[model samples]
Target: MTYEDIRVEHRGGVSTIVLSRPPVNAVTPRLLMEVLSALDDLEERGETRCVVLAGSGTKAFCAGADLKADNTLAAGDSFRDLGRAVVDRLEAFPKPVISAMRGWCVGGGFAIGLACDVRLASTTTRIRTGDAYLGVIPSWGMSLTRLTHFVGRNRALDLLILGEDLDAEAALQMGLVTRVIPEEDYDAELARIAERVAGGAPITFKAIKETIRAQYMYTPAAAQALETHWSDIGGASADMREGIAAFREKRQPVFRGC
Candidate 1:
């Protein structure tokens, strides 16, 4: 599909979604919509088992939302609706989603990274939750919840209140990211991780993802319901059959997202 603000590429079972608005890669409503659309397409295709969300340049994964370009701000419901839609799409994505951070991931940019299941960053990457500095607070639902869950209440509060950027290593130490590798090895490392995830049992991975997300965001009853649903799907899936067959044959499994 044609995209104005992002690029989507699929290689094997790994799909990389790259934010393309150069330099800072600040998101606008249009860009956010495009990203949501791309993710929707990927889910519908059912072939992509892992996704890496990154930016086009070495300078930024994404700087933040472009307040100047966000025309929906004064449009009330549209603005909130768009933000919620993007967050919801990311949260519900069936596969493992990774955010590859290179430079500045700030404000709304940080929100996107937080929405992903895993975040991997270059050692020089910086993260900022800059909402307070802009005279607003973060309104993205699950992103803030996930951030607080990962970094704990104190660090999350410090990030939001102070609006200071945390370097990649510090972010990893604070539990904001899964790994921080040197910039020179960032791309290779991310590709390696993505491929590893893609090669895993697709149905089992989806089940695990659902369970973790439920625990992260839902009440016990709700989490249980989600767990049951995902368990049923995973138990009956063709991917499960493939996994078993491959195991018995001592070969790699070929999953068709079934």
Candidate 2:
């Protein structure tokens, strides 16, 4: 499908989805839909083992909702519904997803990052859930839930209630981002990490993601059951045997999603 709000690029096993709505890549229903479409396309492609999300230009990864745009904040429920869909889909995506953020990442924008499996920030990045200060709450999917899960209740409360922006270092400390890279190294580091993640065994990666999400969604025993299920799937996969063979041969394993 043709996408106007986002650009999808494939490099080796990794697919990078760049938010194309410029000047901040603020969220809109169209943009959100485009993102969902890109994800659908990537997930079906066996070559796309990893996905990276980034924004256009140098301004911001995303500046949250385009307050000035129609069918956005003014449209109310429609915006909320789409926001929820995009973030929820990201959180549960079958393939690994990474958010490469720079400059401003606020409210729904930051929520998107939180939903990803990993978040990478540049030194210039500043993230916050600014709705509280506006006399509103985060209505974008599971923002608060993910935030609290990453940063503890106290830190989550501090960010939400105060509507303060956390710099890259602070975000890393709070576990909001996997790593903070210098502005100059941001792109290179993100590419390196994406390549590394993309090269990993797909079945193992999917199993790990599924198990981690299961822990939060199910009872302890149920979660364990899901883990065991995935364990069986992974253990019986050809990739597992290939991994073992590679280990014996002292060579890098080539994973074929099967």
Candidate 3:
């Protein structure tokens, strides 16, 4: 589908979906819709094994909702729902997904990155869940749960209630980002990481993602059971056999994503 608010680019087995609304790529209904649409397309593309989510330009990953937009306040509910959907979809995405973040990431934008399987931030990255300042909780896409899961209740509360800006280093300490790269190296590092994920066994990656997500909704025992179930599936895959053979041969295993 054609899109005005986003741009999709492909490199090898990875696809980068860029939030293209100029001037900080602020969240809007159209932008959210386009993101979901891009996910729909990528999910079905057999050649696209992984996705890298990013914002256009150097300014921001996303600046949360477009507060200054004419329809933002008028269509608050619509925007919130769309935001939730985008986050949920990203969290449950079958293939591995990475959030390549830089500049400002706030509220709904922060939620988006939290939903991704991994986040790689540039040195310039700044994150916040500043909904409290606006007299609202982060009602966009399970932000509270995701934040608490990542950083524990005390820290999540600190960030939410205080609404302090978190630099990339502080975010790394909080486990919000896997790593922070220098701005000059960020783009290449992001691509390298995306390529590595794309080269992994698809079924195993999907299973791993599903099992981890189960911990959020299921009891520990139930989650363990799910993990075992996925493990069994992975153990039976041809990729497993290929991996074993590759180990013996001391050669790289080429996974077909079965």
Candidate 4:
């Protein structure tokens, strides 16, 4: 499918969605709709094992939504609900989603990265929760505990409430970003990460995501029990047998996500 605001490129097991609107890549209704559609499409493609979310150009991942957009503001009360819904879907998507961020990751952009399972940034990356400056709260419910779980409560508050523009080093230290690569190596490093993730056992990755989600959905006791359930799923798969065989043969295992 074609998308005006973004472009999808599938290479082997990895499908990458790049926000294509340049000069800031500000989010708009079109971008939101297309992104959700892309996610839905990739979710149904069993051959796709992982997704890479990014933005075009070196200036920004997305500078947030276009404030003047008809659907964006109403006495600080509204913006169509589609954006939030898409973000929520991204958060709970069964497959792993990785965000490769550079330049400005502000407001909604920051939230988008938070939704991803893994975040990697270039040294030039500057992230801010730009909503506080607009006198509006994060529409995706900033209090959803994602940021807190990534960073501590106080640090999350510093970004959400204080609206500090965090540089790559600080973000990494806070655990908001998984890695910060040098600008010159960003492209190559991102590809390597994607290759590694896409080559992993699909069923194992799915189980890992579920176990993490279960951590938030269940009590500590319940989550512990849930761990066994996910493990059993992995243990029962054909891929598990293949993994053992490959290990004994000293060869790479080809997982079918079964």
Candidate 5:
């Protein structure tokens, strides 16, 4: 897909979407719209088993919403509605999505990473929950719900209200990021992580993603039902046949994502 402010590179079964705006990759309406558009394309294609989201520059993953952009703050809730919608999409995406972070992942940028299934960051990465020190709370779901899921209510409260900036190691410890790698090894490490997800049985991965998401969104009974539903769907896939056959034959399975 083509976009002015974003770059998408698809290889093997993994698609990497880079936030392509300048020095800080600051959030803009156009940038968010392009991200949604790219997501639509990837979902429809179904060939993408895993998605890795990262920013283009060495400076920041995303600097936050562009207050300096024309009519950004003037649009108000309409603009925030778009941000919420894109984040909802990310939260429910069927395939695994990983956030690869470096530099400043602040404000809404931090929320974007929070929505991903996995987050891996360079050692220099700094993430803030609400940036409350600036009197800015996350308009996205992170403050109300997502942050608590990652770090529990007390820790989430501390970060959201106190506006603490979490470094890479702290983020990893808090479960905000799955791994923290040195800047030198970040690229190679993230590639391996994406490849690991892409190499899994596609049906199994989808089922697992859905089950976890359902657990978050539904009651215990409802979540169990959802899990059972996905399990059934995955159990009947052609990939399952290949997996079983490969087990019997003592070889690695090659999944076609069927």
Candidate 6:
């Protein structure tokens, strides 16, 4: 499907979704809706093994929400619903999603990157979540949850409440991003990482992704829901069986994502 504000390209089992709004790829409601739709398509296709999300230009992965468009909406459930729809779909995407960030990643843009399974940023990237400065709380709760778990609560609070921008190195130190590369090598590095991820066993990747997310998002009590899930599903998975068989046979295991 054609998208007005984004570009979707598929190659080598990796689907790259580019935020295409110029200057700074701000997340307008329409753009977010399109992203949700695109993710749905990718998941349903099952052919896509991985996804990379990036912006159209070098200046910014995204600056934030389109304040001009957002301001036009009345303050009520409609606004909340819009934001939740976008974030919820992103959080629920079945496949591994990577965010390749460059330049300014702020507010909603930062939230989107945080939602991804992995984030890689150029050395020049500046990351910030500035909802507090706008006299509002962050609507994307899971990102903060992840941040707090990855970093300490104090540092997460400092970044959120102080609205401090972190450079790529600082972001890595804070566990907000996985890697930072030079701007000159950013595209090549992103491509290599995406290719590696796409070539991995799909079922194993999905299981690992789900396990990490479950651990990151749940408390001891809440984790109970997943206890039976892994046993029932993972114990019977083809990849698990192949892994054991391969170990005995002293051969590489082939997985079909069953």
Identify the leading candidate in terms of lDDT: 3
lDDT per residue (tens digit) for residues 24-123 in model 2: 9998888998999889888899889999999997689999889888667676887788888898899889999999888899888888988899999899
- For model 4, how does the per-residue alpha-carbon lDDT over 1-113 read when each residue is reduced to its tens digit? 87899999999889999999888888887788899999999999987888999999888988888777675554233344766776777777888899988899988788887
Clashing pairs in 2: none
Q: What is candidate 5's TM-score against the reference?
A: 0.95
- Each prediction's RMSD to truth: 2.1, 1.2, 1.2, 1.9, 1.5, 2.7
Model 4 error, position 196 (Å): 0.7
lDDT of 1 at 165: 82
Cα lDDT of model 1 by residue, 104-211, tens digit: 998778888877888898987999886877887677664456667777888888888888889887888888889899988887888899999988876777777777
81-190 in candidate 5: lDDT tens per residue?
Answer: 87898788888887789998899998888889878888888998998765666766568777777778767999888887777778999888888888889999888888
TM-score, one value per model? 0.91, 0.97, 0.96, 0.93, 0.95, 0.87
Q: Candidate 2, overall lDDT?
A: 0.86
Regions more than 4 Å wrong, model 4: 74-80
Candidate 4, residue 58: Cα displacement in angstroms equals 1.5
Each model's lDDT: 0.82, 0.86, 0.88, 0.83, 0.84, 0.80
Tell me the deviation in Å of residue 252 in model 5: 2.3
Off by over 4 Å in 6: 70-76, 142-146, 221-228, 241-254
TM-score of 4: 0.93
Q: Cα RMSD for candidate 3?
A: 1.2
Better model by lDDT: candidate 4 vs candidate 5: 5
